[model samples]
Target: MAISLHWLIALLIFAGWGLGFYMHDLPLSPAKLRYYSWHKWMGVTTFILAFLRAGWLATHPAPRLPRVIPPWQTRTARITHFVLYLLMFLIPLSGWLMSSAKGVPTVYFGVLPLPDLIGKDKALGDFLVQVHKWLAFGLAALVGLHIAAAMKHHFMDRDGLMGRMVPFLKSPRL
Candidate 1:
């Protein structure tokens, strides 16, 4: 369940990020509006998935790192994971708040309408737009670091950490 949710959320985040960059420069039109709506829906879904993943984590604590892993590296990994989770929640939330401040209602998949969290305020909306953009870039950077660390463990360190998340792959030689 954890692995499935991890990949699903990862896929959604990448797709949403790609769409966000693509639509940013486009002139205001129906297509842009449609893209924004889809992006907003994706953000909402990502937020919910992040919440569910956190609940799962709370119940099922992650396995401990191998004793051979230096204590500092373990600490860094823990911190990185925590920040990643934090960004996962914050990115979408800022986007939602920004939309609310912009006086735009977020309709979930065109079915359910979510209420604005704050009253319309153009200045606040503009601020949140920057916040959301920066948070997303931070997330992208962290994800790159996370992947790099995983690959370093798998290929360079010959650790089985990657295989644990990817069951089909054989554990690397220790």
Candidate 2:
């Protein structure tokens, strides 16, 4: 069976987001550590999957959008996609930097290790940590808007645009 890689990526993205969101303040109990463990694993998985997705995208570009989509909507989608890709690369990078600076090691799926992108630098690490936090917030906003737009196209416009991503959905014609 052909796996829905896009949906898989989306689910991982949301899962990672949830884990990342509360990690800062959560106590490091066994249960809480489990959350961080999942977060770390999910981050690594997302990084690898994103690399695969990018390779796939390079080889097979996305399909042309429906002509009925307004130019503004097209532009927004393009920009949002760009941001998502940026976050895909930057989030893990920043995390790696932050962890490395704090003398922490990153293990991928508890098997392989990832090299730190940069040597430990307290100032730079702190800056990257802040960047990572804000970028996540931006990602949350963009994701929300993207979902809303997809729903609008599906419901209000009765367009099949949303069905492109959500292949299971049956869009009604207006």
Candidate 3:
């Protein structure tokens, strides 16, 4: 369940990020509106998956770092993970709030409408646009860091840390 949620959320985040960058500057039209709707749908789905992932983590817990890893790397990994989880929630909420402020409603998969987080305010909406954008970029960077750390463990350390989540990649030397 944890691994499944991890991959699913990862896919959604990347797709949403790609669509966000693609749709940001297009002239207002039906295609742009459709893309925005799709992006919001992905964000909402990611938000829901993040909650499930957190709940799963609370019950199951992440594996401890390999003892051979330096304490600094361990601390950095933990801090980065916490912040990644935080951005998983914050980015989606910011987008939802921004939509509300812009007088646009988020309809989950074009069906159920989520309640607005705040009353309409153009200035606040403008502010939240930046907030969401920067938060997503932060997420992107951390994701890169996460992947790099995994690769370092798998290839250099041969510690099987990557196998903690992805069993097929467990190093034979472990």
Candidate 4:
């Protein structure tokens, strides 16, 4: 069976989310230093997988929304999907910029040298950091809504919409 690009991208994004949270809560120490590398990896991984998933989606569009679902629900799903992709890319890009602005050299998995996109401007760095934080919060809320809606479809509506995205789930009729 072919691997689901969606699943791969989703997992990588989840890793980014986890690492972002951890790194946000810690000071820059050895213990915190450990999370930095992982955080960087997660960000890089998310960017890569998001690209791959976008390519896959371009080629293989998602299945149609449930016909029984309300029109507003369908619109919400579309908007949520748009927000997910937008923030998934934006969050990592902002993090990379914030790091660069702080004069933090980024290394991708300790091999390739990632470019420092921003100069050493303390003001710019602080601004980007705040932007990153707010964007992350927005993305987190969107993700929560998406997951809750999926759960609602699966349990309350007994629809197979969630199953399409969650590959491990059995179809409702099965």
Q: Sort all candidates by TM-score, best to worst.
A: 1, 3, 4, 2
> Would you give me the overall lDDT of model 3?
0.94
Q: Which has the better TM-score: candidate 2, or candidate 3?
A: 3
Query: Taking the tens digit of each residue's C-alpha lDDT, what string does model 1 give over 1-174?
Result: 889889999999999999999999999999999999999999999999999999999999888899989999999999999999999999999999999999999999999999999999999999999999999999999999999999999998887888878889876664
RMSD of 2: 2.2
lDDT tens digits, residues 10-110, model 4? Answer: 67767777777877778778878768877877787777777777777788787788799999999988999888988878988998998899888789988
Q: What stretches of model 1 exceed 4 Å from their correct place?
A: 172-174
Q: Candidates ranked by lDDT, best first?
A: 1, 3, 4, 2
**TM of each candidate vs. truth:** 0.97, 0.88, 0.96, 0.89
**Candidate 1, which ten residues in sequence have the lowest lDDT sum?**
165-174
Clashes of each: 0, 0, 0, 0
- Clash count, candidate 2: 0
- Measured with C-alpha atoms, the lDDT of residue 24 in candidate 4 is 76
RMSD of 3: 1.4
lDDT of each: 0.95, 0.79, 0.94, 0.81
